[model samples]
Target: MNEIKAMEKPIKFSDPLFVTLVASICCLLWGSAYPFIKLGYSAFDILAEDIPSKFVFAGYRFILAGLLLLFLFRVMSKRKFNLSGKQFSSLILLGVFQTGLQYMFFYVGVANTTGVKGSIMNATTTFFSVVLAHFLYKNDKLSKNKVVGCLLGFIGVVIVNFHSNLLEFSFSLSGEGFVIIAALIFSITAIYAKHLTGSIDVLVITGISLFVGGLALTILGLLLGGRVTHFTLESTGILIYLVLLSSAAFCLWNLLLKYNKVGKVSVYNFLIPVFGALLSALFLGETIMELKNLIALLFVSIGIYMVNRVSSRKFSNTLES
Candidate 1:
């Protein structure tokens, strides 16, 4: 408590430096999840076709992540769970869509698609987030740059996935289509989370929602005859890493969304695919450092710049005007 009392000041989560550093770290961690999930399948001896096991695996990761986060905040931050009936229901709704259904579709979808295609489809979350924010938030309405930025980032995602024939692009209802649906669900629930954070502690919101969603997934998976049978040292280690990453990433991301314009923060989501592709290459022995990848990186960087660059200049003009 003494250490907590000596805290200097509230962090300026809106500061460009803080936002850039934290948001990038969150995206990088999320990007790493792509390869880690795939590795988890191999390590656990779960075949790609084993959908129920995939659900069980993800359920355990998030259940543990949620508990870890809840304990940390309760102990260190002295956070409480004095939620109203409405607030409690709101959190349950957020968890069901955000953590439970999103991962249910995402795990199955990614398993059936190529890594490149999965990453590309995941980028659609940003698109959905930005567009939804425009309609939902008065302050985060559509802007010229926001549209252009999204398109550029989307183009980059497409480019990175263009490994060979343009005709190679194909979509399956259970594969890429499921990924798109997951992305949409995530975007919609994230905006709802931002709304909840206006009244509730963002960390508490993240923790409770994750655990609630994970519980649902676990129960459903078990009922469907899903079992996590193999628990080797390596697979257990991977699961632990996933839990830690999800806890940290989701906590930080919720804080950012609570403080920043949803569109501004969501635009950085483009980097997930870039980091995903690069990390997948490094860990999975896929191609890397190609000309197209560099081009895609350039496009993505430029898109992020366009969305954020307007803010710095606007701040300056406000001072001078």
Candidate 2:
């Protein structure tokens, strides 16, 4: 007589190491975005003999990125280029909210503020995501750990801003306000994306959304007379880098979301400000006020830890169920 053997289910999510690697790559790509934007702005300023409007620059870059994404989608997937009615509508909405409006706010914010400051402000996306997710998704309950994490992250944001204030506070309130708006948009996008996870391929959705978003920006740019008068090597490089890295990271980020819990993947956003500050210091020679920056990093780290802990508990519960 032979004994019966029970078979184990295969893991639905990617392995821990792979998820970590992808997340790190996404962070690094996103972290470098500020410096690249600064470089592009500098080049634009050089050519224009004055600051090129942020909206103008961002509008062009996003359109280019969107086109590139569509091209890549066609090459890689070889799927039909047509969109269904539902997909078309969803992509249009996503494009407007995520790519078009979000970047409009972010570029304007960065134009008004220093790259380092913009990066620090961008960290608020994580906190806002928690709030948005709580309200948007019935399954996404606000647990104690998540609440603590959000509070800790908010503290870090305050510390980072406080340090900036100590250093003369010359920053524009409008700029900071734009960053906050951008964060809110991103949070909304993340929460909305959670609903789309099972319905479409991440790359497909990203490409379509970007293409549509880019087209809208292009139209707006044309209306505003934001013509590309000239392009330099630096501007070209920045555009290319932004398009490639952003597209790649967007794809990977979506993949991570599909495989992992939202809270777990979102913890990575906590690293954005911390890494962005350090990278800004290293590359752009921005001042890194040691005490405050360290405190902010600590808060962000604790927040991330809480997010992870809560996510793990939730995952375990699902497994048991």
Candidate 3:
């Protein structure tokens, strides 16, 4: 009984070690999203022109995720779904941009590009978040080490693409362009989410935004003639996994950002592509032992180490000063 109560205790945000454990779990779950989404595309038979269907699929995933989160929170904490008008409006806005626009762009973008290229491109979210944080928070200003670290991470992403014909420069605005745009959107909204979570419960914000955004996506997809096929037991099971990851990853990520520096937390995003590539190979039966993939992983790991070193030094200096 005492062990159960102890396990249920709240996370200690001030403890950097605990924050890293929680945040890393969130990133790992999100990293798995890349391959799972590709599998979803296959299961649902979502083709390139089936953009609307993608939206519908995402809608189902997130709506259920949101509802599940609400139900779990209610059961665990006995909290109600009470919210003021302002909170409701804020969540609506967060939902529109964060889950709605971000995933809308992501699904479409991934459809048009190779999985390798798409995963690498999507990593720009870290850079975007770091830059945006510098401007948004006085304490989170970009340092020389941060710039070096970000550049190294970006270079790692670029290196991974060298195995392909990246110089073809045939980047479609709707495809790779949308992926980049989605990263920007994610970065911006993450900052806003952190700010909002300062006042509102992370669970409330996550649930409301996911539900509102998901509902909108579902309506828009159906209106645009989008349909989901292959509603078999297997596909339903896959979808349930998606819902689980969405709820768990987003909720935990929001809490991490709320408690820590955005730049410090966001740098771990460099690992997503590494994980994505590895997982894609594992699940999708693609090649995994390529030299480029290993090299890319090394570069990304170093970048993560560099960024954290600087961030840790900064934190220690602040304490001393």
Candidate 4:
């Protein structure tokens, strides 16, 4: 038995190189979203002021993503998805918060802000998670590094709100403010989803919540006089890409979490905004070379690095204690 076990290969998911590649891919996919979503908006001819139509577009993306993920799970795992009344109710609440309300803020925020600024602002999600975790878990209490990290992260966020002259300060609630709100919601969603995972498969939770949330957005948008009839090959292709990316990225991220420590894998998250900024510059013609943008990016990156610098020894000790 020992010999046979020794002959078996270890799971690639836990291997360092494999993890790095997958984690980087996941972040890259997520980062591409910042630019692609803006492109999506332009393709569909959705105006910046059209809130209801944005809802419609976001709803469709999540709805199809959820359905596709569910189908893939069924085929790949061959596991039947079963939900109890309580589970169903919980999923509905999650959908409302995680998908419906969160995306509402995100889409609105992205639409109103430059993708470069919006992406950098969204990095606050990690800081929010760190702060929230400190309050919830004794083992996850804040350290000096965590506090400093958070301050740096916030400084980055604040810096981005300033003009090139450093004197004129302009911040939009519909843009950066809303993105920060969405980031906070995502922090909360991460905690809530972790709790729910004890009872349900992570995939199922994500799939159902996304579907229900999308349905809510679609219905709400229609109720609020939103219509999306402008569908071209480009628009349709972009929409499909959005759906596929959402499904693939979320599921892959969860899969990584399943096999690795959150600290080790999550450190790669800083790359998301980096990718977002660069890609936004590449695709949306937005520039991140401005003094404020560069400084903000540097601060945010350093802050995130500080926050997620937990060594394996520390993580293991925390779990044991």
> Candidates' lDDT values, in order?
0.85, 0.69, 0.81, 0.74
**TM-scores for all candidates?**
0.92, 0.81, 0.90, 0.79
Q: List the residue pairs that clash in candidate 2.
A: none
Order of candidate numbers by TM-score, starting with the best: 1, 3, 2, 4
| Candidate 4 segments whose C-alpha is farther than 4 A from its true place | 1-23, 109-121, 151-167, 170-177, 256-269, 285-304, 313-321
Among residues 3 or more apart in sequence or in different chains, the pairs in candidate 1 whose N, CA or C atoms overlap within 3 Å are none
- Candidate 1, residues 1-321: lDDT per residue as tens digits? 343333212346766667888899998999899899989999988787888878888889989999997887688777577899999999999988899999888888988787668878889999999889988888888889988988998998888878664458588989999999999999999888988987887667888889988888888888888888799899999999999999999988988888788888998899888888888888889888878878988998889888888775765575578
Residue 268 Cα positional deviation in candidate 2, in Å, after optimal superposition: 2.2
The clash count of every prediction, one per candidate, is 0, 0, 0, 0
- Candidate 1 is scored at a TM of 0.92
Give one digit per residue, the lDDT tens place, for model 3 in 1-321.
Answer: 243234334436534567667767887887788789878878878886688998999999989999987777677667676788888899999999998889889878988887557766888899999999998999888888788888887777777656546766668888888899999999999999999976787777898789888988998899999999779777888899999999998888887787678988898788777777778788989898878878887887777777778656655676579
2 versus 3: better TM-score goes to: 3
Report lDDT (Cα) of residue 139, candidate 2. Answer: 62
Top candidate when judged by TM-score against the true structure: 1
Task: Count steric clashes of candidate 4.
Answer: 0
Kindly report which residue stretches of model 1 are placed more than 4 angstroms away from their true locations once superposed: 1-11, 316-321
Top candidate, metric lDDT: 1
Minimum summed lDDT over a 10-residue window in model 3 is located at: 1-10
Distance from true position, residue 22, model 2, in Å? 2.5
